[model samples]
Target chain A: MILPEKTIERLSKYRRVLINLNFQQKDYIYSHELANLIHITPEQVRRDMMLIGHSGTLRRGYEVKQLIEKINSIIDGNTVQYVTLVGVGNLGRAMLNYLKNKNKYLQIIACFDNDQDKINKMCCGIPCYSINEAEEQIKKLNINIAILTVPTNVANEVADILIKAGIKGLLNFTTMPLKVPSNVYLEEYDMITSLEKVAYFTQFIE
Target chain B: MILPEKTIERLSKYRRVLINLNFQQKDYIYSHELANLIHITPEQVRRDMMLIGHSGTLRRGYEVKQLIEKINSIIDGNTVQYVTLVGVGNLGRAMLNYLKNKNKYLQIIACFDNDQDKINKMCCGIPCYSINEAEEQIKKLNINIAILTVPTNVANEVADILIKAGIKGLLNFTTMPLKVPSNVYLEEYDMITSLEKVAYFTQFIE
Candidate 1:
């Protein structure tokens, strides 16, 4: 069953928190505690858990490891998903540094750039290929999801190339809102817009 | 008047696009054209414009420069909003790089970090101060909003310091979800959650 987009985002967050709790040797977490950590209502957490067909006992709450495994099974399925990065700029390298070796099921296998010096090198241990070779490299590496960190002027151009290369999902880092095919899933992480939103809210704080 | 959060985000986007169009010597934009550029429905764009109390002619559409000025007056008011960036690491540096000289109204005037090497230096032309100096520097700089790019382990600790120093809003980039006081506005930009969300959607793409 498909979950709402907001629900999917929250599940990913829940899994992150659960993995951390598991690392601390914590076995179970109450919906209230989890909700508090994520800054959401306890009722929202319970509803999400119910949506995923998980229930918690009043005594033990929810099993942390079991919930993580369930989320992994649902979100990631069985095999690892090969992903790619489309730019090797400072932002791109920062993303690679943060993402590399972080997840078992989602892996950034390759990166592409138009810069000659960066091409054919390893950025944060992932291979960097020339943008000219993106279509072939993406197909050969079986990459479906891509992280786009290119300049705004070339963002749509690069996105077009990625879509043409059969990329099904994109995480866009540029401020330019992109247009994609209906089948292609796009997530725009515009720092400027986010910053401005914060700026707007600051005015209300007395 | 306080606009919806989503509407504020869209206004910021419209302003960005309009600024570009104005720079290109374009004077007016129809709702459909603006919506197409931003990947939104024309009705939604028109509705937002209406909410902002702006109108356009059928023949000329909305005047680009006038709408931008109106958005600026509403979103930013008269004074520039000073912002502080904590954690001068890769992500922090990248943010400074992107935001410097980008906007006249929103300025990242300072950055804070625990690293001695990073402190007491200029990062992307902004002053880098020690975490020990966060409270003083923030207050002295009149910073009301902070962009947090610190490690997950210390995210909450640093957030407390920022809030205590009188920050009214926070844009969090760490993977750990943060809990802030009710008066504080928090925006979490979790790359892991976003990546995983894209990963989930990729499964449905044929």
Candidate 2:
């Protein structure tokens, strides 16, 4: 089943909500209640839930455990992805430290950057390589995913190199757009635009 | 004109691309070439450009200056947002220390954490506050946006208090989903998901 882009985005939010419920020892949840928690219409919650192949019984609502497993299966939790972080700047390095043993399902295996002083080193046990050695290292270590936090100027250049080295997807931290093949999945994150949205929407007529 | 969610996301990317181009002293850009750089169809880029009311001549493409002004206008460049980074963890504090401040558009107003020793202190002129005083201080300062880098466990509770105190948006760093009112916008970022996408598309299936 092909979920829409919007649906996939919501799955993470739903998964987080379920995790919170699990922590709270809540066993079941209803569409309306979950919707209220997420600030969406109850009908919308039901629709999102339906896409994951589960729903609440009128009285029983959605079983928290069952729903989590269902979402997990759809979300492919079994695979622990071998990931790499490039750039190792403040944002990239922070990401490197954050990913250190954070998730059981995905792990950062290596770090690469152009900074000569930081090159040929290790960040949190993940080896760091200079950009000159990136392709060789990525290919040698069999890294499939890359988190790009390089400056916007070099985003595409790094991405193209990664793609050439057989990277499957890119998580872009720079505010630049990347040119990748259709086979490649890309997610662009801009921290500034997010701050800007809050600023503009403060007294938004809409 | 209401663009698709996908397009709105792309605009941020385009603005970043244009900024980099401007920095490189590039004067003009063609839609096709720009599309080629970003891995999108020229037609799609042209359509998005149209949404911003920007026009580029056939060979000349779009005037870089003209396009940038239009983008800034559409994105509302009038208000400079002041962001509060809650929790001076690796992610939060690094962002405070590293992100370029010359722009002065999105300013880090203050930072808060649970540590007592760091309270009422300043990191780069931004005050640090105790978590106990967060709600009151947030309200007192009239902070409109918050960057949450606290632990996943306390993410929800902190965000709940923030929403109640009239926070309009959140740049969440924790791996938790925050339940907020409909009027509030929460951008949930998962570093692991960024890696998983690269793995699933690149290798797991094969």
Residues A1-206 of candidate 1 have per-residue lDDT tens digits of 77889999999889887776454388788999999888899999999999999988999899888888888888898679999988889888988888777788899999999999988888889899999999999999999999999988899999999999999999999888999999999998888888889989889889
TM-score of each: 0.96, 0.81
TM-score of model 2 relative to the true fold? 0.81
For model 1 the TM-score comes to 0.96
Q: Write the per-residue lDDT of candidate 2 for residues A25-130, one digit (tens) a residue.
A: 7788888777776557888888888777786899968888777777666555566667788898888888888876755556688888888878887865778888
Regions of candidate 1 where Cα sits further than 4 Å from its true position: A21-24, B21-24
Best by TM-score: 1
CA shift at B178, candidate 1, in angstroms? Answer: 1.9
Clashes of each: 0, 2
**Cα lDDT of model 1 by residue, B84-181, tens digit:** 88988877888778777777888888999989888898988898899998889889989999999998888999999999999999999988888889
